[model samples]
Target chain A: MTNAIETTNLTRRYGKTTALANLNLSVAQGSIYGFIGPNGAGKTTTLRLLAGLLEPSSGEIRLLNQKLSGSGTEAQRLVGYMPDFFGVYDDLRVWEYLDFFARCYGLDHARRRTTVEQLLDLVDLTPRRNDFVQNLSRGMQQRLCLAHALVHDPPILLLDEPASGLDPRARVELRELLRTLREMGKTIVLSSHILSELAEICTEIGIIDCGQMIVSGSVDAVRQQLQGGSHLRIRILGAVEPAVEALQNTPAASRLPAIAEVRVDSSDERVLHVELANATEETQAALLTHLVTSGILVSEYHAQTENLENLFLRLTEVMS
Target chain B: MKNVQFISLQPNPIIIKELRIRMRGIRPYAILTIFLIALVAAGYGMYHLMLRQALFGGSMLSFQVGQGLFSGLALCEICLIVFLAPAMTSGAISSEREQLTYEMLLATPLRPASILWGKLVAALSYIFLLIFAAVPVFSVVLMFGGIAPWDLLKVFLLLLITAITCGTIGLFCSSLLRRTSQATVISYSAILVLIGSTMMAGSLWSYFSGPIWQPVPPELLYLNPFSALISIVTVTPATSTDFFFGGDVFGLPLLSQFAAGVVHYGPNGPVVLPIYRATIVFYLILTVALYWISTHLVLPRRRWIPRWSDVTFAVLLAVLIGGTWLTHDWWRVLPPPSI
Candidate 1:
């Protein structure tokens, strides 16, 4: 698959302070790429560079296979950019606002009407088309901004902190809208401090800190790269103290260092948790068998996997 | 051809959007009503004042009344336009940035020049609407007799040009300043300097230069639209023709030398001073150049002129030099010998 967006040594500097440092990023076509960072972490700067709003101090950006530098209007046509905060004219009706942007994208009269109506329908804002923009709620305004971004139907969309002020229901709506856009084969590169939001929607993730990309890859790949091993939860029905004691004395636990530590659950007294170190499924099975054979009352055992949140926390913690 | 076709196809969305928003509110209507009432009240007061003065009898009194009414209303209109233009235009671009819509507008395929033109045209159109509404009030002067239809037309044309020039200055200030308040202040201050200082400078030069040479130097008067308006309204062909360049310079007759206010060439022909003409043309060129530079300032990377804006600028300078050469008669220290 061809890359939808690519950058080479994209560095943006503000005098002595480096906003984005020697960053190279690749977002595959049709993939939902989430840019993760803390406040003042150059996420907005990177998106602005991609949107062609800010010229790179020294670098190149390619969107939809077109070189962005000095390409003029041709490169801008291929990407739709929405900044973190944008204002709407209060006097203009919602349809007029979309119509104005659609016209700016060079849509003709007939096409502007049709496109505006279709977008309103897509964002579920058709009822408010005749209503003034100022009268709409914040969530509606955000949806309107999203609809504004989609006016030209560009191949790539760069959104900055899109779900920042949205309520949970609105966030869910925005998430669903993004999913629908992904289904239509639009490459989305969005930056957000809300890791949970990104984790729920992003197929690919790039974590940046102090102006450098710390880690970037597929969501599962990044998680696996940070995860040490698997975790096991063992629930004992009666006399949990004996089960814990027996597990510590088991020969399999001593024979294989993969069974690193076993501790009782702090919240639940009846449950015991086991941490593995570089352990495979076979070793896990052997440990389980030895535990049963040792005459310990182990009622149930299950493996719990490490998620993207754990990976994010571990990587960010290491950098900090 | 392709560029022209592309430009022709792209309707200026900014103009349509701005006009819709401006006209949708009750503010413009209120402004129009107040503006017309003021003009009518001023015109009526002048006519009533002239009626009480019985120094002239019959037709002479009527003509004086007409002239007084027309002159007062025209000057009032000019002052209103000069003040109203900056209010309409100084916020054109800065307001967008203040409202946070500038970035989104820039992100689209719209060029900075298009945005500037759209803003200027929108601002001027509102002012023009006000000017148009006052036309009937000015027409009441026609019922008495001193002013001709052509004179009213000249006044209206000069007002339009002045408004456009002032609007451009406001836009340039708006583009340079980040805050709307700052832009408005700078725009009004620049207009005041352009209007007030030029008149004051001309008067001072006239007082110091002695009475033999035309006081209120025509050259200096050419720089101020208000002075140009006064010269155009009062000077007649016979009074002004024989005074300069044998009533013709560069083989073009002076507009002031014609009773009908038309330029005619020859020794006996009307010698129009063309002070207003020079002012309009000079201001138009200045406005265009200023607007071009402001567009570049807004989008420094994607300039209207690709790489040759500097070259284009050099050419503009050359044109200014050439124009000065053509108008050598007007700027001379000594008055031209009469025929």
Candidate 2:
């Protein structure tokens, strides 16, 4: 897929302090890409650069096939950016704030009203549309910020820790809202330190550490790339005679390491503990063959996988 | 064609929106109160000055007295500009930055230039509103004595120029300083250097003159914006036309022209003094350049241009010594020039 957002060697500096350095980024057109990093990891900087808010000291950024940064604002109009920490004009009610922002995006009065109403409803803020933004709870304020960002109906959204600091229920509500948005085909780039939160919602993840992208891709792909990693956990029943036979005969499975350990830990319950090293597509087939051929009444077979969170820590820990 | 088409589309009006937001806050009322206090003090001074003049002896002092006596109104307006400018603009952009709205606003399609223009227009609007309130106070002068309706126009226009120029200074400081107090201090210091220090320098320059009271060529008055404005507006109401649009070196009114008439005894065909023309053009151009730079300061660029706040502080020390030398009464071998 052509990237909706792309940056190459992008860097920004405030005098001697480097906000972002040698940054490379690409977000697929329709992917809900989670940008995970610790605080001060330049996630916000990267988002701002893509939105054309800050000019790169050196390097380039492109959004929707057009160059971003200085002297052009087309990219800005196309990207909705909600800052991590921001203050709304307290005097304006929820609907008024949305309407004001919609007007800022150059929306007409008639269209602004409809867009405001729709965005408020999407963020579950329709009821509080007439209430002052300041009076809203922190989570409601965040929902309002998200609603404000959608005023222009831009194709892409850059949300900086939208769920951070929100109550658990509010966070769940936000996650569900983002899920609905993704289903509706809005590309979103969300940044958060809460790995599990992103794990729940993001289709893909980019792990940034100390101003550079260590790795990024689908959750499974990233886990697969970890040298010593297990992507799937399987539970088997009835002695696994058919599976063991299928695994032994499978050509691809034959190349992988043998079951490293199998213990009669649950003999009373008629279960076995097996560790399959170098788990991959090839190994999985051979292992499955052994089970099917055995016909040993295979009862439970499921996978509890290690996801992007482990991959991120592995890459960042390796760098350190 | 593209440019024209761009213009035809509606403006985002982001600045105006922000300004409306700002106005709803306490700053507007606070600024208005300060502005009104200055005007009241000035009106009181003007009434007393007029009363003193009539009581002391009418026609004894000359038109110069008439002009100098009216200086209280100009002073009042300047004080208003000085006090309110720092309060209004000093906290403008920096407060937005602190509030974290700066980056959000920057993220929008509103260019820095548009933001600057929006801010300046908003600040000027408030200042104009303050000036608008003082209109009746000056108008009351007409009932008592020789103050013309044209003089009132000149006074208000002068106030407008002072407020606008000072507004630019305040805006520049706002962009550079992160703290409101720093912005205000820097703005006031800039005004002192730009206006007060020049006057001191002129006074000291008198020590080196060929003759002390020689007609100092009316052009020098432009150094003080108040003086230049008065020079143009004080011209006889009949000749106010000659000075308004793109004429002469200075922003002086008809009175300064009459003062110019005291010297230069030749056939009159409006011999535009190059020095006066250049000076007025320079200041006006400077004001425009300031407006332009302030626009860029508001841009959402990651890289910021070098700020001159530190350099300005250093230069001010030099100006202080230079001004002290000029204002020294003992250094003058001849007496000061009469009004």
Which candidate tops lDDT? 1
lDDT of 2 by residue, A1-320 (tens): 77888888999887998878887887888778998887777899888777777678899888877787465477656788898896787877788788767666667667777888888889988899888889999999988888877777777889988888988999999999888877877789999988888878888888887788877888656656664634333445655554445444445525454665554445444444555666666766656556656564556554346655666677777878
Question: RMSD in angstroms, all models?
Answer: 6.3, 9.8
For every candidate, what is the interface RMSD in angstroms?
A: 5.5, 5.8
Shift in Å, residue A216, candidate 2: 1.9
What's the TM-score of each model vs. the native? 0.87, 0.74
What are the runs in model 1 whose C-alpha is more than 4 Å off? A246-257, A303-314, B1-8, B55-60, B202-214, B235-274, B300-321, B328-339
Alpha carbon deviation, residue A87, candidate 1 (Å): 1.8
- TM-score, candidate 1, is 0.87
True contacts kept of each: 0.62, 0.49
